[model samples]
Target: MKLPIKIALFLMALLSVMAACTNKNASQRATQTNTDKRYSYEYVKKISVTQPKKALQVLQHAEEHKLMSPIDINILRSKVYYNSMLDYKKATFYAEAALNDSDINNRPEQLMSLLYLAALEYYNCGNYAKCLNMADRAITTGYKYDNRRLVGQVLTTMGQCHSEIGNVGHAINCFDRSIIIFKGEVKKSPNWNLYYALTTSNALKANAYLEMKQYKELFQMKPEYEGTLNKLNTLPEGISGVNDLANATFYSIYAIGYEEMGNHAQGSALYDKLIVTRAANTPEGATFVVPYLMLTKHYNEALSKVNEMESVWTRSGKDTIDYNYIHNILANKAKTLQAMGRYKESLETGIRAYDLNDSLNRRIKAQNALRVSEQLGKKMLKKHIERQETLLRINHIANIVIGALLVICIGLMIIGFRINKKLKAKNQAASTLVKELLLYKKQLMDHLAADEANNAKNNRKTLEANDDKQQQYDEFLRMEKMVIDRGLFLQPKLERSDVAKEMGISTSHFNELFARFSDQSFTNFINDLRMEHAAKLLKDKSNYTIEAIANECGVPIRQTFYRLFSKKFGMTPAEYRNVVADE
Candidate 1:
């Protein structure tokens, strides 16, 4: 009886302990839930443009405490940096982090936002192809989710990319589509976002028209642009909350349009407004350099104003200057200097601008090569998978065939496998050769730049010792040597017109240079290089046939090759080979 009573008391004590443990867990869970809610609210809703620094502190605190979703935090961080601080690199980093997060794989809305932001950052970086690719992805995702606003934004960005690349027609089409979508969204709900999109789209369209020299279209759009500007002004300050750089761009385009339409007074007034309203120390004010340039082209005090603006830009620090933007600034500065009769300074600035432009072009080409390689890799992977599936199917059929007709099937399969192996080996070798060729081409381009610079220096010394006519003759000789050294004549379709364009000289000038220097026409000069290369190849006892060597030397027809070789070298290709053998 005493044992049973002890067991009952022990059971009651055990149940009481269990109840206390459950209550503690419940309280802890409630506290965690409340903390999560608070963090989410503070990071996502309570944060404002005016309080980005404080918002960043809250974000850091939340991150420290491991509250809220990581993707959510990253997205917010990207927005804060992009919208408030205008730090595109940091913004892109966070946006890309959000994109690469596994947590957002199934969340289309979040993924779409990250993609659109990434596209914008790429556009800012001047990676137009990557920008277009990301914009396309975002547009597809947005359409799948039936999100019109996201689609409109991506389309607008796509338009900007096209505009940057000088695709005016495609740019106009994209802008129109985005404007239509934004108009529809506004019709449903009159929001500041939609209004901003509409205004920016129309402004970009006008800018495109300006680029295409469609003055009639630009004039037609002027009244509409004015009306939109008026409406935009009526909105509360920062209500649209769009990119201030873009806002400044819209105003600049408006002013440019007025100037193009011969309203110099109105254009001047608008320029004054832009200069005063957008402080020169700001990013938006960096765009003011455009108007100042235009003003300098027409007005008198513009040079002093541009100088002041340059001081402001320098004070803002070099980190604030974007690569492409600075290139434009230097170009405009050079032009302004020329207008002010500062020829030496203008020439130096122009050379700097040209060098920067060339660097940017080379970078763009390298990026394009990388992109193409990636796409080819994907295609090759897909083809490989398909080939594997096909081989498996073939193997299955071969097994069946072997059972039905053993002897015949065995022979057929052996032959088929051998052929397949040979083809694969050949393809692999071809691919490797192609890759090596691309590498060689890139190396050749680098060597070409260095050679051009060296040649320029040599020619400058030559010029110092020569008269103006003699200097021109020397320059032509240097250019001709460059063309021959690069083997440009090996291009079968290379023409005098093309070479003239490459040299940045008129066709008539090219002809005059050739006549004065070589005493031979351009055709004879090209033929001479081909004959020289052919002679060298023939002497080397290369495996190439006469016709093949001729083709390689840019003479396609065998008869024509013989005629040119006999005329230039005093013998046929075979006779040249015989003489080379005797030597």
Candidate 2:
């Protein structure tokens, strides 16, 4: 459904308001905290390199000891994930928590925390529209304060979100702006944000151009194998941002560009290299596994890839909406089935892919809803506090006029006490609502876990069924081989009728035999065998070009050969041959 433009504008306005108010408070806190800076400055610098999980622990200790300001602790809490962990949800949680605190608004770190939370949430959820909104908010705040690094980072993140949602033109605009800041070295030299923003903008611009199918722009931007490899190499070793699974994604895109440019051999080879690099950096031998997904033809391999991605995200405490990674796997697996000539099975896979995508969208929107509720909760809390302060001031003023209206004043005091009691009840209710919101968050995570598990189970069952069918088909292939060896039929274009006649049966009866033995019609079996044989022959560098290979395999046209080879091999004939040769 199309989002109403008016609503989008309204949300943008609300975000602006939130940013303005938060920034005002942040500024005051920043002044107070930095005034006594000797201890905090050294402590903050020392903990910069700490792991996110460990940083959270340290921050918790600081909070307990009353050594850290709520502002400082919140900054640490949010940064623990945003800077160190890459866990978007926790980063968002702490950032939002920090923003909601009346004490932390307007500080540079608080502004950064809010921006980081919003950007990461949008990126992780695949909600480009909201992501862009948050990025705009962050950029606005950062620019107002001359925080160029935050501006650059938000611009790059906006570019990426635009790329993800197919907004090529807008994506490039963001990347261009980010590049300007990046070139100026506006951010601290050693700051990871600089490298991350530049590389992200570059990579995303490449992706945007690729999506547009504009090879010239893509190449002009230096989105090629050699260039990306150089950048990857130049990236500092053990830098968490540069060599992650996402970094390997650039290589994947480069390989894709090569494939699209009709250099499948190079593309396939690059793909192999990409998988190796990704697998190495990916913790626990578990990566996003997109490469394994693209290369392997087997359904089990696809299922395994999804399972591994899910496991890794779970272990890392990453958002479940990271399902895009797994959804891509599911979508590709359907393509693989189509390549394998399993059209019926492919349809089923496609359905599963659709379902998974739908589930992901729903979960993401739900998370966004939770964020909205959190913001609303904070607004209400502020209003309630302000009202209470107003009432206290009013009571103090009323006390001075208390002679004849003493009874009335006492009555007013009793009424105020009752109102306070109700306020207390209301606060308790609000706390319960917050608890429920957290529960909802956990429930959503659990649902994602369950969905993935069920999807894996379903895939395994389908694969087992396919395995059984393949076994039957293999038996039929063996029989066909024996018959061919014996020169059972003279016709070069042998049909099922001939096979049935030779086996002393009617065509219909023979079809039943074919179905029982091959799991598909005789025609599909024949075509699959012919294509498989042609693929094998094509792999022999000594034999033939694609056209000759096609002719020899009894597939008449070059286009048909290209189509069939790609369908059977998950790549073009040349790509398959090159991949085989490289192996």
Candidate 3:
């Protein structure tokens, strides 16, 4: 059953060539790095809904354009290649790419790249042991690297990997550690990662409790979990300007948690809310539609919504990631069709869902596989270091035993020592590079701080300017009060000459002075003062109807009430009164 040697070698040669073609330069890698920060999750989610070819093109564009940083790009490239395309070989390529260049001077970013690549490899191969091993490396590296949040994230991922592989005790341990870390740091902020991490840890904890039949404890966790979710919901909509995937995920998880706690009605309501929110925010034909998956039971309605969403996206050029939405709805449609005895239609819809799932699995696998491969590479490096040390010891022993060989060995040893010295120099050089990078990072941070300080100063100056303007308004008020003391604007049909007489000035000089001081014509100023007083009188609901208030304030025309009120307050007198009543 073995292939002939010639054919086998030829196939291997072809693969090697293909691999070489996909290897990218740093700029191309940089594009992926930037995109990773912004779009990695969206790409993964999109895999469930979009065609593999289209997803591949998206990754290619990022790579070709050099839109992201190298480490970020490698993480994303590995993920997109592995998960969406199911190209394990390319996934391995990018994971290794990420690992090789992951030294960011800052330990946190380096560990993050390592963590991503490790997880990608493990999940793709469905190798839970290796996944945990990689995740362990990430957790350990995070500890060594002093990034508590990354450590928590790794622990959560480790828990999920164990849960998948049926290692309940280990999963519980991982989840417990993750919860401790999250409680220590993640609770203080509204980070989306923190929310998801918390959800995963709680979900795992609840599952463990469920397994132990500790129903009371499981029930108790429900309210705390829901409270966390409520806090998440109330957070100011983030400035990211896209639908908040983390919030949507919270609702989805809460739906599960609530249903398990014997709150089916609440669970269903959450699901409905998730669906509505997603529909409103999601773009058409864009691949992120995880929220829509819950509505599978309502297949016809879901498909209609999907079509509507697709139409909107198409018209507006928006991307939609809804693979699960498509699969779940189509599956439901197939089942409904089958129940109605329409086997052919059922088969057709089922086939569509099946095909879509294949695409989804490919994308997930690609990203996961890269994660696993990166972990293995780190283990290999650790092993290589150990082996080198052992060899050096063996050579030292050999040199002592052979005296004639000792002289030549001593010279060789001197040369080897010199080479080691040079390598140390290179290591120092690397450290220098790291220092320079850190200094540059500090400069950028300082610049940002300075810019912010400048902005604050400018804002304060603007406030002072506004206060000056308000002071001018106050002066106008004082002048109006003096005129009021002399009984201007009191007549039922107030005239400018009456106002001038009240102030004891000629009409011409009175008009000029009033206009110069108040920045309004005398006639206009008098009418406005009358209107302002009339509006205040109208607000005294017990004493004054609109007509009575208008008469008392010396503006007797009832129709004028409508015009003046609308101009001054943006609503009619009746409407304003109704608004007050509601308040």
Best by lDDT: 1
Q: Residue 506 deviation, candidate 1, in Å? A: 62
Q: How good is model 1 by TM-score?
A: 0.51
lDDT of each: 0.64, 0.56, 0.53
Q: How well is each residue in 310-342 modelled by candidate 3, as lDDT tens digits?
A: 455346442122332343345545655665566
Q: List the residue pairs that clash in candidate 2.
A: 22-106, 23-106, 25-105, 25-106, 26-105, 26-106, 26-107, 27-106, 27-107, 339-567
Q: TM-score for all predictions?
A: 0.51, 0.50, 0.40
* Model 2 RMSD vs true structure: 26.8
lDDT of 1 by residue, 1-583 (tens): 0111111111111111111112222343345544555566333433435466777887788788777567767877876665455455576778878887897776676677678777776666566767788889988998997888778777867887777777879988998898788789878966544566677677667767877878788778878766665665666533223333334555566566677678878777766666555333344344444454454475234455545545655674534334433443565567678887889988998887667665665554554555455657877656645755785688689879878798777889999999977755554454345336545755765666676677677755664776789668656866676677678899898888888887888999887888777877778888877877787788675578999999999999999999998786555787667555644
Q: After TM-score superposition, what is the CA distance of residue 81 in candidate 3 from its true location, in Å?
A: 6.8
Model 1: residues >4 Å from true position, as ranges?
A: 1-58, 80-87, 235-250, 279-283, 296-322, 353-583
Question: Per-residue lDDT for 133 in model 3?
Answer: 68
User: What is the full ranking by TM-score, best candidate first?
Assistant: 1, 2, 3
Clash count list over all predictions? 0, 10, 48
Span of 10 residues, lowest total lDDT, candidate 1:
1-10
Off by over 4 Å in 3: 1-69, 76-93, 102-108, 120-130, 168-173, 187-196, 203-219, 233-243, 256-264, 279-583
